[model samples]
Target chain A: MTARAAMGVLLASLAGGAGYADELLPYRIEGNAVPVSLTGKPGDAARGRTIVTNRTLGLCLLCHSGPFPEERFQGNLAPDMRGAGTRWSTGELRLRMVDSHRLNPDTIMPAYYMIDGLNLVAPAFRGKPLLTAEQIEDVVAFLATLRD
Target chain B: MKRFHALMCAVVLAAVAGPAGSADIPLDQRRSGYADLGRDTKAMQDDDTSNPASLGVQDGEALWSQKAGTAGKACAECHGDAAASMKGVAARYPAFSPARKGPIDLEQRINLCRTENQKAEPLAFESRELLALTAYIGRQSRGMPIVQSDARLTSAIDAGRKLFTQRIGQISLSCAQCHDDNWGKQLASSLVPQGHPTGYPIYRLEWQSLGSLQRRLRNCMIGMRAEPYAYGAPESVELELYLMWRARGLTVETPGVRP
Candidate 1:
C-alpha cells in the first residue's frame, strides 16, 4: 500500500482496532459526481434540512445563503444555495459535498467525507469525517430538493 | 466603506498569492478588526478602568520595575519610564532586527532583552510574565498609528503574504478567504474581522486572558485545520511583519477586549 494509505490505516487503528475509522466507505468520482447514493438510497430530506440549518452540524449557511427564511442571518461568501437542485444533478451535489477541492483546489468548502491529507485536526475530530456518510446522504437529499 | 471589498478579496488574494508579497491595499480600504466588534466590547476596550485587560497591564507595570536574572537588573533601570521609552516601540514591530538579520515581533524582542541584555532566562511564550510585559508595553502605544520600520526583510514580508493567501488544511481555505474576502460578513454567529494585528496582547473572551498575536494566529490555524507554527517561529514572525505592514496607520489599542 502507498504511504498515504498506510497512514490512513494507522489512523484507523488509532480509532479502534477494526481498520475502520468513521467508516469512510469507498466511493468513486465518475466525472464530477459520485453517481450512486452513499447509503444505497436517497436520504430523508426533512432530516437533511435540520442538518443544513444547524450551525455546528452543516455550517452550510455560514458560507452559503439559502432559502431558509427563519435563519435571520446567512453568509455571503460562496454562491447562494437557492436553486441548488435545479443546477446540479444529485450525484454532482454528492461529489461537491464529499470534496469540492477536486473542482476548485482553492475553494474554502470543507470536505465532509474524506479524512486523509488533513493536518492539525483537533483530537476530538481526529479520526472523524466532518459528516458521516449517512449525514452526507441527508445533506445531499436536502440539496436535491432545492429548486428555483 | 470599501463596499467593493467583497469583490476585492478575490483580486487581493490573487495578487497576494502570485507576487512575492503583494498584500498591499489602498489606504482607504484598510479596516481594523475593531470595526466589527459590538458596542459593549468596544466600550470595554475604550475604558481603561472597565477593561479586564487593565489588570494585566498593572501586572506588567510591576514586572517592569522588579529586578530579575544574575544581574538583578530591572527593565526600569535601562528603559526608564515605560510611558516614554515604550511609547512607539510596539507600534513599530515586528521590525527588522539588525543583529538577527530578520524580523522580530514585540514578544520575541522582549524575551531577547531578558536573555541577552539582563542575562535572565527568556520568558516562555504566552507565559503570564510575557503577556503582562507585552500588554504593558503595548498600552504605551495605544492610539498611536501602527508604523512600519524595517531596514530589510521585504523577502520575509513577501513570504508572509504568500502564507496569508495560500490555501491549507482539510477546509482548503487561506487566511485571505475569510479575512480579506469575507470581512464584515457573518460566519455562524460571529462577524468576521479584517484580521489586523493591532492591539495585542488582546484579552480574548474565549481565552479569558491576555494573549499575543501568535496565539490568535494559532487559533485561526486550528480553526482552519491547518498546522500552526511554533511560538516565535520564523513563519510566525514573517506573518507578523506582513500583518504590521498591512496594518500601517491603524491606531494601537493595546489590551483590547474582544468576543
Candidate 2:
C-alpha cells in the first residue's frame, strides 16, 4: 500500500479502538442550548484546570484571562474569567467551546472541538480535532465551578 | 459657553485618540520590538563590532566589487559606490516594476540585476549570498524614513491589506486580530507589537542569524497554522508593500536586533 494509504489505515485502526469511539460526537445547536453526549465518565475538575493552563494543550491563557495568579502576562484580547460560572451555564459554555462561530460568526475565539472548514491544517492534524470529547467535558466541568 | 467647552473637550479627545479612536494607537506612539530588546541586544545593534549582522554586510561588500558572469561586470561598475548611490535606496524598495508588471522587493530586484544585467545565475532566495547582499544594501538606508510606493501600486497594496485582514487556517485568526487589533496585549508571555516591516534582513535572536522579511512572514503563517506562500511569491511581495506603506514614516533599522 502507498504510504498515505497505510497511514490512513493506521489512523482508522486507532479511531476504531475502544476509548476513541467518542472522538467524533454529533450534536445539534438549538438557540443557545448545546447538548453534550460524552461517552466517558463525568469529567474531573482538577484535570480540567491543568488543561486550561497548559500552553501546548489548551492555550486558553493566550487570549483569555483567568484567575490563575501564578501565571503572569495573561492575554487581554478576550473577556476575563473572574466569574465565568455566574456569566454562563454549562450548556452555553459547552456550545461556545465546541463551536463559538455558531454563536458569533465574527468571533476571534477558536473552536476547540468542531473541525470542519479549517484551512491549511497540518498533515498529521488534518482529520483530528484539537481536543477529545472527554477533555472538552473536563474543561466544561472546571469552568462550571468558577463561581464569583 | 458650557456647550462650547464640551465641544472643545470632544475635539481635544479626538485629537489625542487619533483616527481609530482610543483603542487604536497611532503608529508614532507604538514602539518597535527593537525598543523592547534587552540592554545586551540593544548594545549589539548599536556597535558594528558586536552586531552579528555586520558579518553579512562585510560579505556583501566583497560580493559587490567581485566580478562575475559573461559580462564581467561588478555591481560597483554600474551602481558606482554603494555609500553614495545606495544611500536610502532600500527605503524605496518593493517598488512597482513595469518589467515585472508588479511590486518587487530588493531581493527580486537583485536577482533581476544578476540574471539580466550581469548574465549570471540568479541567487536563490534566502541564500547566503542574497541575504548578505540585501543586508549590505539595506544597511545604507539605516535611520532613513521608509518611502511609500508610487500611486501605481495602489491595487497591490489593497490586495495586501485584504490578505492581512482575511481570516484563514485552523486557528482562524487574521493578521489584524493580533497585530492591528490587540497590539500591546500579551500573548504567551510576549508582547504583540504592531506588525510593521521596518528592519528587514534583520538579525533575530530566535533565528540566531540574518533573515529577510519574507522569512518572518512565513514564520507567522506557520504560527497561525496556515499555508505559507512560496518565497518571491506575488502575494508575499504585495504584503511587503502594504507593510512598508503602513510604516512609511518609521526609520529603517537595518540589521536590527529583535527578540
Candidate 3:
C-alpha cells in the first residue's frame, strides 16, 4: 500500500478497534466533535492550493506566513507554515490544522471540526458547519507537501 | 423659589442615577431577546448579593499593603488607608494632568503611583498586579460620582467622542449604534447595556476575572470587527476619557461583578 493508503488503513483499523461503527459512514454527524468532514484523495495539490487561496476556503495566509510566493498582505499571527511537512508528522499536522485551538486553549485559531462548542451570534447561522468535508482533506493534502 | 431648588436637586439626582439605570439599554431593544437593564439594575442595587469582589480585588489589597521595590513604601504609606484616602479618587480620573499634557485615566495614574509613590516598577497593562491594584483602588470609589471635567482636554474628549460615534471594523457598528441608538436591543446571548461607566474595572463572569475599561473596549472593537487599539494607546485613553465624561455623575462601582 502507498504511505497514504497505509495511514488510512491504520486509521480505519483503529476506528474499528475503538468500536466506532460509523467509521466509513458517508454522511457526517456534526456537533461539538465533528467540525468538518473529509473526502479528498491524497496528492490533490492543485485543489489544495485553490482551497488555501480561496477567501471562502482555507484563507490560511490571512493569519500565517505560508510558501504561497505570490500572495501578499499576510498576517503574522501564527507561525510560518512554509515547511509544515518537515516540522510535523502527517497525523500531527492533521490534528493541528483541524483544531489548533484544542492544543492551546488561548490560541486565537478556530477548530475546523468538532463544531458544537462554537459561539454563533446569529441564530440563522447556528448549527451550520464552517468548512465542508472534501475541502478539509484537500487542505491537509496541500499542507503535507510543504516539506522543502 | 424654594421649589426651584428642589427641582434642581431632583434633576441632579436623576443625572447621577443615569448610568446605573441605563447601563443595559442596547440588549433590551435588539432582536436577540438577551438583555434587560432593569434586571441588571435590580441586581446592582442589591449590591450585597451581586457585587462580590473578584480575585483582582484580593490581589490589589495585598499589593497595596505590601512593601515592594526601592522606596520601601507600600501603597498604604503614601495613600494612608485606601478606604478613606482613596475614596472619590477614581471618580475624578481621566481628568487633565498637566504633566501628561493631555488626559490621565486610572490606568496611567496607577502606573504613575507605582513609579512615583511606591518607587516600584510600573505594572504593565493587564498584568495581574495592575488589574488587582486598579480593582482595589477602584473599589474605594464605588458609589462615588464619576466626575471628570476640563476645558483644556476638549481635543482629547472630541477625539474620544468621534471614536464613540464612528463605526470601524468589519461589523460597521459604532459604540453609539448599540449604546446610544438601539440600546435595549438584543445581540445574541447577552444584553448590550447603555455603555455606562458606572460599573467599570468590573469582573465579568465570561472573562472569569476582573478587567479594566480598556479591556472591555478592546472586546467591543473586536466584536465590531475593528482593529483593537493597543493597551495604553492614546486612542484608548481618549475613548476612555470620553466614556468617563459620558458617564459623569454616575456612581462608581469598581471591583464590580458583571455577567
Q: Best-fitting candidate, measured by TM-score?
A: 2
Give the per-residue lDDT digits (tens) of candidate 3, residues B1-259: 7777566545533443323222323322322112243477447534644554556677888988999778888878777799999888888778778897999888799888779876888888888888888888888897787775555676777688777766554333467756765454344234446677676677676787677889999888775445788898888999998778776667786766667
TM-score of each predicted structure versus truth: 0.83, 0.85, 0.55
Model 2: per-residue Cα lDDT over A13-101, one tens digit each: 78755444434687766678575545346677899999999877788898888989998878887888767878998788888888888
Displacement of residue B120 (Cα, Å) in model 1 is 2.0
Choose the strongest candidate by lDDT: 1
Interface RMSD (Å), every candidate: 3.2, 3.0, 13.8
Residue-level lDDT of model 1, residues A1-148, one tens digit each, is 9999999987767865333355688888899999998878888899999999997778888888899999967887778988999999999999999988788776778888878777556555666677878888999999999998
| Per-chain TM-score, chain A, candidate 1 | 0.85
**Best-to-worst TM-score order:** 2, 1, 3
Clashing residue pairs, backbone N/CA/C < 3 A, model 1: none
Predicted candidate 2 versus true structure: per-residue lDDT over B56-130, tens digit per residue = 999999999999788899999999999989999899889989987789999999999999999999999889999
Instruction: Indicate the DockQ of the complex predicted as candidate 3.
Output: 0.02
Candidate whose DockQ is highest = 2
Candidates sorted by lDDT, best first: 1, 2, 3
